[model samples]
Target: MTNDDSKVGDIPGKRSLRPLGGVLAAMAVSLTGTRISVVALPWFVLVTTGSATQTGLVAFCEMAPYVVVKAFTGPLVDRIGPRAVSWTTDLASATAAAAVPLLHALDLLSLPLLLVLVALIGAARGPGDLAKEVIVPEAAERGRVPLERAMGLSGVIERLASTIGLAIGGSLVALLGPLTALAVNAGCFALGSVIIKLALPRSMGHTAEEASSPARKTEPGYWRQFGEGFTFLRGEPLLLTVIVMVGITNLLDAAITSVLVPVWARQSGNGATAIGLMGSVMGAAGVGGSLIAAVVAQRLRRRLVVLTGFLLAGAPRFLILSFDAPLGVVLAVFAVSGFGAGFVNPVLGAVFVERIPRPMLGRVNALGDSLSWAGIPLGGLIAGAAVTAVGLAPVLLACGIAYFLTTNLAGLRREWQEMERTGGQSVPEPSSKDDASRGNANLAT
Candidate 1:
């Protein structure tokens, strides 16, 4: 649906959700499509190739370009504006996604060709996803919505999309097969592109576009813009610490979802059904937790909520599986982890939004998020090798221990003190003077 509100200022003492809802519509669909791909792609490789190493290799091909391209595309998003970047990239992703099954139908698909297409999809998706995130603050502002509430709502949307996507993915893969699921994924990407291009007001994302028009010809170049984002990220110890810690966790998480769990499903003879069930249970619980956090997390102590969430979310599933726990216990651990994981991103999002100003959101977000996600590409590959070399239990144990140290032990550092103090705040728009001073600081540093 189209957004009815698009002005810069919020109505006094009144909240509007139309703008945020409009943005979330496209975002939610695209995210769901990604989750579905997470299911369909791996299974496709596993069954067609019957090789876990190849599965991990395919994942690495997709994510390596995804991380690198996204890191560099942030400046482009700021220069061209999120809406344009989002729609264009989504369209590109749709085309790439559709090509896969089409080629396979003609018996033209080969491993190298498939990897090439997957890489293209990942490259397009990086800019697409970053653009979507850049729009959140603008959407929140235009609707006059509270930043924390809006961010929390975004977290809820992600969880719900993930939940439904996994459920649908499992059923589709089990019944209709991965090709059918791949076709549906193509449709989602196309639909998300249309929604963003047509449903949002022309006035949306005007800030970024205006900042980079021909009249501002002397404005900082792309590399300079990227450098500023990097410098700012370097200066913020708390943000750096958080990114490093989360990067480790993201790596572990990627290994689990992409390699470990899929292998576990196959080895146990539970197959896709078990994989679907475990993911769906965790995702469903995550939705409930995200909904609760959306309402009350902004009011709680940030440090406690975040650490508790990590503690609950991290390590348990790995440990549980390592012990060869019963089905019910495994599911229970997944559920608890999902619930705790729900509180994490909302708190992190709020802290992120509170710290960065409007002007810096595009570049800084690109840099910071890319850095945190840097290890993800390697996760699947490493896990596959480890599983092959040392066996599953040992690999799982090492990852669990590493996750514990990265998240829990690292939290004791002084940088995390900032999380407690800045839990529920929103940043004001940066003025011209503020922007100038920041620009000078970037140059000086």
Candidate 2:
């Protein structure tokens, strides 16, 4: 068998972890930075504006462009090469992120200015995040790791970032101030850009069309490429089902994190520290769960795991917070929830990578992710408005019920049965000639 197919323990020589390690490191810093901002930004807005609606508006501004730009950037990422796209966009995000604090310090930061800066950050970050995801299979191959395990490891990195970043961000926001956390966020973006540019092998993450069959010498236009992804995704019932379900849950999650939790903390007198502590508890437990998934997920039934995970991961946190629960009870519920949440992404990511052809990975993944995150921009906005009108308790109860219903009802769909199939592997070759020939019109290499 070829070395590429070798299992981790059975490799002929040393397995190189550099490629995977670099990617993980880059993911770690960037996600951690983002998480820190999650804590810092909302708090900053709430304290300054004293308006939950405005806080939600800021989140809407950031994520709206994130979803829109990401939906359309699939073609650019595929053609320009993910590696180049990753570093350059990260650099742009860094600059935009840095500008937030600089403008504030100069006493010139207005609401409009903040929104513009964050919108720019979101725009650059859309493709930056997509590029990082596009390279995961290549990183796994170079590391001689199983794709599922690699995805699990990626989840672990994400959770770890959430843990560390939240903890630090809370402390920074509490003691030094939000501006400090914002500065750190900018630094993390810069560091991630550097890692992607300098750490990985120069040959890595090149344009897929360049490495594909000679028929790819001719490439389709941008809109044509975008349509290909939309068409392929439209035909896949399982993927579409997954996307719809995930989109609902993502909206709920965004609401919970961006507005509900923050409002709860303030109302309960728990403040920013509690926000960090709760998130840290959950994230730390998630790290443990992701580690186990990395080891054993390949042997499990993915649909079952996913359903069970959602069962644990959803509803309870919202329900618990609906009442005047003590801090201990809240933390315990969040820990269990986080643990369940950890197993989800690895399996989902594996399912996505396995089913889609390599040549179509960029556009397909971008479309899939964008769809799954479609409701996020409105999540905080709705939550903020709901909390303002009806109060936190009723909104929490309602969201919890909605979360419960969405995940459970989704399991009834027959498309979920396809989750068990071993469809395609993340090999360099195309899954089928039809898939490979889709963009063979005028691709520039």
The lDDT of each candidate is 0.80, 0.84
Candidate 2 C-alpha lDDT tens digits along 1-445: 5442234422323466776888889999999999899889999899889997788789779988998999899988877678888899999999999998898899999999899999999999899999889888767766668777999999999889888887789889999999999999999999999998876665455433355656445667789888888888887898998899999999999999979999999999999888878987888999999999998887888889999899999999999999989999999999999999989999999888777765677898999999899888779879989998999999999999999999988987898888884543433332243244343322311
lDDT of 1: 0.80
Where model 1 places Cα greater than 4 Å from the true spot, the runs are 1-15, 43-55, 208-215, 262-272, 387-391, 421-445
**lDDT tens readout by residue for model 1, 1-445:** 6344344232332445555787789889988888888889999889889998898788778888898899998888877678889889999988998998899999998999999989999999998998888788767766656566677778888888888887778779999999888888888899999998876655555544345556346657889878878888878888888899999899999999878998887876768777777988888888787888878875788888988999899999899888887788899999999999988888888777666655567788888888999888778879999999999999999999998888887788888888764323453433442354346544533
Question: Which residue pairs show backbone clashes in model 2?
Answer: 218-440, 218-441, 218-442, 218-443, 219-441, 219-442, 219-443
Clashes of each: 0, 7
Using lDDT, give the best candidate's number.
2
RMSD of each: 3.8, 5.0
Report the alpha-carbon TM-score of model 2 versus the true structure: 0.86
